[model samples]
Target chain A: MSPVNLSNNKIKLSEVDQSMKWAGLLFIISATLWLLAGTALGMISSYKMHNSNFLANLEWLTFGRIRSAHLNAVIYGWCNNAIFAVGLWIMARLARTKVRHLGLLIIAGIFWNIAVTIGIIGILTGHMTSVEWLEIPTYITPLLAISYCLIGVWGIIVFRDRQSEHIYISQWYILGALFWFPWIYSVAQIMILFEPARGTVQSLTNWWFAHNFLGLWLTPMGLAAAYYFIPKVIGRPIHSYYLSFLGFWTLALFYSWAGVHHLIGGPVPAWAVSLGITASVMMVIPVLVAAINHHMTVLGHFREVIESPTLRFVVFGALSYTLVSFIGSTMSLRSVNEISHFTHLTVGHAHHGVYAFFTMIMFGSIYFILPRLIHREWPSKILITCHFWFAALGITIMIVALHVGGWLQGLAMNNPELLFIDVMKGTIPWLKARTVSGFFLAIAHIAFAINVFWIVLSVKNKPAVIGTKALFTSPHAK
Target chain B: MDWYYYILTGFVLAGLIFISAVYAFHWALKNGQLKDLEKGASSIFDDDEPLGEQTDYSLSKSNYNLHTTTANESSKFIQ
Candidate 1:
């Protein structure tokens, strides 16, 4: 047993839980700031895609720059870091310990924030490699990679001291993601930035990085959250531990090879694309198993909690994870790829993963964690419900519109008689719907930012009179 | 533009619906096997208490296993 550090807990705001608390709050800040920045960039890019005159004055607000910012802020700033905060908490609690180098981890948070600041700035300043996700240029990659390492090392430190000898399903995923990220990021950076492979192969490397960016960086983290929360919510051990192993093995085996499907019928080798399609198709098994396991476990007693804002968003997100993966596999088929690959369908697919799948889970985990961190519950159930609806409806409308628009464009482009403008004419209505949907989503995000800020501020002042709840029955009211 | 296209689209949509339905059925089964819940619910009344002390599954609030048997499994009634 490790020596008791009783002195650590007696300080002003508990150094023990500080590892979890500050890190989580930083994530809330990081995610919100990035979200605001990302949405601003997204709207910019969206506007530029159609109305190219929208931001012609500012070089930093150019389409290429805005696109990169949108991706980086949302991916790195919002989702991954937020998961890191929650993942650490879940890891610590399961380990029957807190982060050992708590102070260092907090310092690493400072480092991470600094790295993201510089990376985003670098992108805006025209310092991008333009390699899709690895867009922060050579100078920023090392900083981002180093920051991730610092965070990763602390995760390993937490995992080393576990009360439960058997690693939980969530732990397996967190550990995998922790280790997998460095290897993927370092290799992608080295191959794309330093070496600069030419032409078709460079495209290959780009696709490789893009695919693995989601698979290695995100899929593991999101699944880990789902694994922890789904079981935790229902208060049951996951339906079958064996199925968890099956899901993990298949995902690791197939998903890494599955990224090249994005380059189907392109300059990449036919063999590579075929393998990608095969791997993607095989992805169905793992995705289905995971979705079934998560859904089934939360079947009965928690039907009520599903209506509860937290579970509602999380489960919807979980369902989206399954849907997106399935959609991804099917789209990888050559027949489907012909129409969907370069269309708005692709945009829809991407959002299915990022916004629907990851964001929803993040929302659920935030709801689960806030009370624990601040010792106060959310002020109003109505606001939370409205937040869920706005996001849910907005995303639903946007995805549907994109898919329909993409299909129409694909059909028109394939036809011999139709001009490209005809396709544009058809897509105009869907894009209009998307802008409206974006407004709804943005409002929801702002509402979330306010709610979280309110909860944090209320901790020192008058705590909100949170309604009676089963799990969040906190006695240590602030 | 041909009969095959019609067949293909019909088959694809049907397959998708089937897949969705199967997915739902799996969810329902996992949540609670309806027959099992019905059986468990009914068993509460059909059987009287055993000749020993009563068992309270919820006794240990924190450590309680919700999946462990609460119903009188030996008889068709609830005790």
Candidate 2:
């Protein structure tokens, strides 16, 4: 704790920051490019829902192919790569080690992007698997799998080389996520795709895999980022370590079991559905534990959280995590599931988790991380404000329209007197509203991309100005 | 046949996860990892120096036992 030691530690972390510069920049830039691409594809798919003939002529632009393309591009391209950038940086930073395998990571990152490119192309070419989340063709999955392992190895190495004896809670979540993903992914791929599990088992494996992908992989990484940034930015410890322990273990226990709820009312055994419903509802424990822990830590710091872009986005994400999780738990109940199961309600719920909860947190973490890695202030607070409002407002509208429309659609479908076409017709206006929200999200992402490029590409290293009104305080200042 | 196996697999996976959680919780408790509540939470901010002088005041009062080993300070000195 001597000043001399502190100085040395600063120098060491500064080196680690410099070491991550190129790989982090590449991962982020690639992630943003894919975000732009995915948003475009999403708009096309959304528009086609209401106007099926908009691009009906082009076989490649057919709704089915384009929709699958959109998912893979966003999930693998944007989400995965962004996690690589942000998550790996976090692992390296908290591990207090320079990234050792920089060259391998870059190579792995390149191949990861290439593999996803081939996967998207495969989907467009009518080779997509009919499975919901695993729609990417079989040939490209191994490449994606292998490259993910390669990138994941660096995190493991950083943990191995960590100088600190007491591992932070974020590392536990990150490490668990790093290891859990490939295990689940490989099992899902082998059982469902390669061996082709018989009948409803395929459905079981599909939902199990898809839901776990969100629960274990994306959720842990998002929570880890939140755990790190909320405490760091607010300059306070978490509310309680006991709650964190309970939260982590309970989440690990409950989330994996909750996946089977997705198969409710299907041919699956009633007992299995019951188990899933129980697990889903039980998820409230961990979700609230985490929510309370985060909110308590930010207690009396509301003004600070609101002022800091990073805390604002992170707190919003944490709030959405709480909201979406509760909604998810409720929707798993047989009564609620019956009505919301086959409608756009599930779609809204999905975005509420992935985009609102996970992606927004990543965006916030990037705002904190990029400035530190590049050692510069944000070029424009106005742009940051625009991005946040646009994204926030856009997603809110989309979810609301989809939820209301979906509920109505579900009701109409259940009634014997309502024609099928009538139910379909009732959803058009909502779908159009969703498309408009997509434009807002598109504008938000564009602003975000521009701001990131300006920060990364700018040559001037002007000292950052810090104030209560600043978009972000200089990383050096803290 | 597939349904039975699928059900069995789900049970096995859940059982394994349950056991793992219990084991992890036990280890955390045994190792005293769950104690020093404030220090554990602030450990992530170790790489950075203290936020400022005002932070040092609050941190000192908050982290009673390991007042000198604040994560921001300990993080710098651990190496």
Candidate 3:
């Protein structure tokens, strides 16, 4: 708060950014490559859904393997890499500490990506484990765990060496996720893959791991970005510190328990199913708390949200978090899960959480962080706008088509009088719509990738040529 | 093979979460982290990236000058 402290803080912040530069750039660039790869595979998978013969000739491109590969590429490849770039940078900044041992971190990052590459290759090459989220082959799994441990440990070390006496809310979320991921990932690996749990316990553990990976690992990191950027961009504090505290703890407590709801209607016991359902429903408390906090902080910043690219993407993600979490809670109910479970609706819901909420927030964070990390402005505004609209519109169409088609499909299937062919026939149109939506997403990602590389390749310290107006000019300057 | 596998897995996972959560909460309370809600909320902002200042936007010639000035000033620290 003091003048000298402020100056010192600025220097510290710069130091933090400098420390993250090479490693952060490496993570982000790798993430972009994976994003393109994953999106292409996703398009192929979507097309195969409607027209099965599109890639029927290739054994590795078989629908099942391709779909699993796409999932891993996006999850482990794109999302994790982006998380490393954005999440770690944020952690370093909030902790007010310089990230030391950049070489180790970079090596960990490289190994993590290498492991993912090998895992995706293994999945496609008939070495997949057949487990839902653990499709990556058993041999490659330990490398991933080890690489992740190396990367995740850096976050903890940063926290341990933090200069700030009062821990910020973002730090809490990042720290919690840093700790939670390894525990869940390793446990899932040991129980479900390495040791091989018996019978239905395997399925139960599979769902537990898969859901917690999303809920605990990805969700927290995404929320951490949203919490930090929304307020930081608008130049305001979060609406209520108490609400953030409540949101975080509640999410931690309930989300881990809610994974079992995925096994409803399975061989899992009634009590376990009930516990999952209860936990899933109880998740509303945290979701609502976060929604209120985020929306309230951005209450009158509509103009800023429009002007600042970072605010725009982050705000969109923050809104989607509210929407997706509520939908997820609703879907967890026995009545709803019975309808939505196996239908394309669940697929839509997954994208709603992962792509719309988590991915969008990451996009926004990159927009903010890259400028500081690289000390170069984004090369083009048109590209950023193009990227936002395409991504936003694409995911919107995908979610609607899948949810509506899936609900209808679910309804028709439940009515046994309806012929099975009719149910399958009804889904083709929706699947085709999904394929169409994939094109929009593809274009969006392309635009984003172009902009990232453009800035990276552009001369540093050069003035931006795209727009003339300052989006975040000082109040006095205006 | 047995039902206790379920219980054991459940208890262990749940216990880890519970113990960790309690520890975090206790540490937070002891460190006075929960006391000053307002200050903690505003802790993210500083003079360089001060509150109410939109620091990032799509770059343009008009804003480019402003950005570069900040860049120049901040560049000193990097060296």
Candidate 4:
């Protein structure tokens, strides 16, 4: 901690950020493009739910294909790209290592996007695999896997080259995610798609992959960002290191088994279903641990949460993680699953986890990261505020509408005397409300995209040197 | 036959994960990585970005100036 060493550390950290600049921007820019595309498709699908003939004439835009395309575009195209960008940068910074082999990383990123582009087109054109999370066609998946491996390798490389001997909590999460994704992904593909598991085994494998895709992959990456950003922004240590240790290990142990609960009342064996429910219920331990840690850390820093755009979005995401996880555990119960299964309630729950929790954290990470990468402050605070409110309010409306409508639909469906047509008809108003929410989400996304492009393209201010007093005292701060 | 395949695959995958995790936990414990929890928690911050200083905020002129003045005072005190 000598002055010279402190200065050198600053310079080294600056170097780490500099190395990630272009690759991070590439991933984020591509992620935004996918987000806009997914939003458009989501709007169409939501409309078609209420009005079947909204685009019935177009084969490619049929409801099934469009809906599946929307899911893949958001999860694979938007979420994964954002994870690569934010996750890798965080890993490199915590490891205090400069990301090497920039050319390979950028090339792999381009190929990854290309594969996603092909996969989306395939899904739209009716070549989709019809699997829930693995809708991308089999032919395109190998390319996706290969490119992902190339990109993911850099995380391990950065870890291997880390200057720090003590691995931070965030590093553990990122590393776990980077390794877990490909393992689950490849196994699911081989079992469900390539060899085609027999009978109920295929369904089992499919649910296993689908659930783990959220539980193991996206959840870890999202938590990694929360763990790092929450403490980093507020200038405080995590509430309890012991709690984080307990949380991480328990999540790792329980989450993988919890996915089987998706098949609660299906043809699966009673023992397997019971195991899933048990694991799901046990998830409350980690969820509570994380909730207490995050809430306590930010308890006195509420003012900072309001003032800092990054902290606001991340804190919202962290709170949603707790809410969504608890809801998920409840839904896994056979009694609750009986009502929620195959209903729009499940759809609302999915968005609650993906958009409200994971995507919000990614947005916050982008807000914090972009200034450091570009060496310039965001051009407009109004746009950031608009983006946050519209997104928050829009998702809130959509989840409420869907959950209420879905519960009514579920109740009606369970009644043998009720006509199926009437049950379907009852959901129209809720579907329309969802379309309206989609419109709000679209506006939020457009505002975000506009702000990003404006800041990137503008040359109004001189670049502030990072890791120096100038960064804090720039005359053109805003 | 299908049940056998399912059981074998499930057990193998689960066993691999369990073993790997236990090994990792053991390694961490043996390496003293878990010895100093306090230092580990504060390790993400550096002298330049020390503990108890807000480094990011929504862009605004007044807030920016306030933060800059605080940072200047902190730096002078450190010197």
Candidate 5:
């Protein structure tokens, strides 16, 4: 064995980390700050749902604006920035190449954050486009799209000069996501906002864009992180090569069509809705294949899963992906959609996929990637532990409350005898529960931010402990 | 009339993605991209372990095997 030098190799190992340090750190810090802001906005919006007059007098804090602000902040500000950090780091490492255009990436990241900032402010100030996830105003969309191009092209360039002859599954997903996001964004923007699709067609385009944004952009990126981290941490390979390929190709083939299922009973053509249903059901193949592969690989490694912070978060995300995708497929059925559509169930379902699955996985990737980038160790395991528990419990409470409460609300609405006021009243308690859950999530975010800032502020406080057998061998190697 | 354009765009985009995927899959197959399935999976460990050394799968598998065998032997001895 090569003499493992904690002191000497630490400097050597960090050459890779130094290539990405500034851009990666900036993206992560920015993403965590947005997470805090989003958490606050989410809490306010949930409170307003329960008590309509909580901030009724404030025009800026109205439910519509606050909720839109929360979504944009988390999706654009938080998730996109995190992906820029985590995704690019993974691509560079896997390709065994240093990131070029570091300066451009930093500029693009700054511009991207600035665009999201202005976009959120625009939404709050009533320049909002009111187009679901695309509420980031017309002016800023172009800026974001341009900055994203500047940032995203680096991944492909890195791959072009890769030292590794074989492209790993993670690269395929990352490359695909980088290509897919701009196409979907531009198409949705042009059709829905610029030219303006007529009536229900606009709604179809909206759902199409919204759903695929999650499916293609966030889902694949999240899965890519999980695929890379799980095997690396466990010191084992994925279960089956064939299953991985099937999962990827089937996902690429079926996910785009599954978007139309969002407009199941709408004025859209029945043929279109039927196609959506078929495609949604077809999603089971990919989801199950991925689930089986992950589960079998980690089957005997439960001890590692419990010990490693990264593995814990990632395995939770992998499990939630399975759960959420299954629920989503069933919900697309006509009978299920009858009760679930136009209800809080869909809202809960969205949080399940985006928060529980994607966000948790992103958190995992950050934990594993950040230390390497900074050439240091996390200062506080207590903070990390607390953050995990708070987030897990918070999202769980929110999802359960929303789905069950929404079910009753849906049933009550279907009844001709029941007054609408009573149905609204019925959801108040659940919304209140959701508000409390938001506070838990807020605490989690604060803890995470503190942990990050503490490590960053004291970057050189601890000696470089990387390149040791202990830290690399086990997740519990603190 | 514009709605037809929207619908047509969707179909064309879908067809393009489908065709691209097929071509990529064929290319991968022809180039032996999928031959050593285990290699790519093990490559991620480069960050965790010593550089330039691919993880030995058979070694790890045998370790796991030894673990289970020890457990079985212990249980039998206890009985």
Candidate 6:
């Protein structure tokens, strides 16, 4: 694409109002800080694994602290807050409603940051919950829950007082996630912490909460962005309203029960595991529907996708959802989980969901919002393409390395007589490769941070240039 | 936790029902119920008037007096 100019098309200033700019700017600031925190911790975690004594003496910077810090910064500080802010802001714009109780949103943002701050402190001080994805201490969970409640409440208000009555497809996903997330979170907490539940209930609640975090909350947020950005970029209505609705309902129906599949081969009841397997398989229907709707609708307009970074990331994200769901269901099979469980394969599976699936959506959503929210186009299209390549390559290498390394480890462990060092030797190469490629990913993330910073801070409007280019266009202009 | 499982089982069951209802609503919509929902009430009101009922969803034409204003506007755009 040529030099991107900002003036010709005359941006919708009402869309880029002060409230939007402020909220967008704050989110960017939060994201950059979170990136720094997540990256530093990630590198430490990587290095300390191979060289155990690298940071062994530092109490606050131990591997566990860094891991929890990394997770919290990336998930809560970086990903969720940023997406929630952008999602709610965009919904307001599309619904043609002014932001309500602006002070409340700012206060909520403060509460959000405070909660993360305390969570990070607790994790570093060895006060973690020790549960994967529930590492934040009990004291901090209430704060995060309250902040989320406020944000969801604001969304309901904005959606309720809309200019138009016909609810858009995007609203369905966002609204579902907004309401459903609390149900999953609160129930899990109440059972796990406050009141002890009966036999197998803790594991059931744990898996239920963890699964819904992806299925109900993260997926909906991503899908909402998908439903909105896809049509907005393509400049066409969804191929079929019926199909979009079908995908929504099927996902809600099927995604919940599948959480139990994660506990396959564990002490969970037989019926529960079977139910999870059934639901996991049933998830294919919604996945297929959404895939066809997103991919087919953009089929004839391939050129636009090539030039547009937003579309590129979103398409990758949309495709990854299919791949991840497929992988998730397959891994749930008893025979498969027997080998893959407790192996790095599970790590690869997770990255497929988190980095490949959800983070891609976050990346795409940020790209789509930066221009509208900040009133400036990205500094350069080349940087955007470079960022995607590095990220895609990094995640690709990480997952493949882990999968292969894990299969070998699984084989070695099965021998029972094989030395643990033998398993380590086989996987060490991949772990090293993961560290190396992760550096590239770190750079890509920094590149993205820079791009975001420029968009939010730069205000001098330049001459507008046509920017109909899709993301993966050949760098022939090189 | 045992009691919680029972509650979760209820949640699971409720979620299934909710999703089914949403699908059913969409099925009705796909069958062209929502686009014509305005007619459900408007037709009742139109009965009192001498104008004909809205038999089709071709809002492109000002075929009825009750909707002549919207139909006429659409006709101008069609040109």
Model 2: per-residue Cα lDDT over A395-426, one tens digit each: 99998999999999888888999899989998
Chain B structural similarity as TM-score, candidate 5: 0.50
lDDT of 6 at A288: 87
Task: Enumerate clash totals for all models, in the order shown.
Answer: 9, 0, 1, 0, 0, 14
Per-residue lDDT tens digits for candidate 1, residues A272-376, read: 989989999999989988888778755763543443455677788888998898888889999999988788889888888888988888887787676667555
Q: Which stretches of candidate 2 lie over 4 Å from their true place?
A: A1-12, A465-478, B1-27, B47-79
Error of 4 at A448 (Å): 0.7
Q: Top model by TM-score, which number?
A: 4
**Residue A335 lDDT, candidate 6, scale 0-100:** 86
Q: List the residue pairs that clash in candidate 3.
A: A235-B52
Quick one: best lDDT, which candidate? 4
lDDT of 3 by residue, A1-478 (tens): 3212443433466568878899999999999999999999999999999888997999999999999999999999999999999999999998787778788899999999999999999999999988888899999889999999999998889888787767888889999999888888888887787777787888888898899989999999999999899877766678887999999999988998899988889998999999999999999999999999999888866766876788888889989999999999999899998888889999999999999999999999998887678766676778888999999999999999999999999988899899999899989999999999999999999999998898789875343332532233222121
Candidate 3 residue runs with Cα over 4 Å from true position? A1-11, A460-478, B1-10, B59-79
Clashes of 4: 0
Off by over 4 Å in 4: A1-11, A463-467, A470-476, B1-13, B59-61, B65-79
Ranking by lDDT: 4, 3, 2, 5, 6, 1
Q: Score residue A186 of candidate 1 by CA lDDT.
A: 67
Give residue B31's lDDT in candidate 3 (0 to 100): 85
**Which runs of model 1 end up more than 4 angstroms from their true locations?**
A1-19, A460-478, B1-79
**Model 6: interface root-mean-square deviation in Å:** 19.3
- TM-scores for candidates 1 onward, in order: 0.80, 0.89, 0.92, 0.94, 0.90, 0.82
Candidate 1 DockQ, CA atoms: 0.02
In candidate 6 the C-alpha lDDT for residue A198 amounts to: 66
Tell me the spans in candidate 6 whose CA falls farther than 4 Å from its real position.
A1-19, A461-478, B1-79
What TM-score does candidate 2 get on C-alpha atoms? 0.89
Please provide TM-scores computed only on chain A for all of the candidate models, following their numbering.
0.92, 0.95, 0.96, 0.96, 0.95, 0.91
- Evaluate residue A72 in candidate 1 and report its C-alpha lDDT on the 0 to 100 scale: 86
Docking class of 1: incorrect
Candidate 1 pairs with clashing backbones: A299-B31, B43-B77, B43-B78, B44-B78, B44-B79, B45-B78, B46-B77, B46-B78, B47-B77
Q: Which ten residues in a row have the lowest lDDT in candidate 4 chain A?
A: A1-10
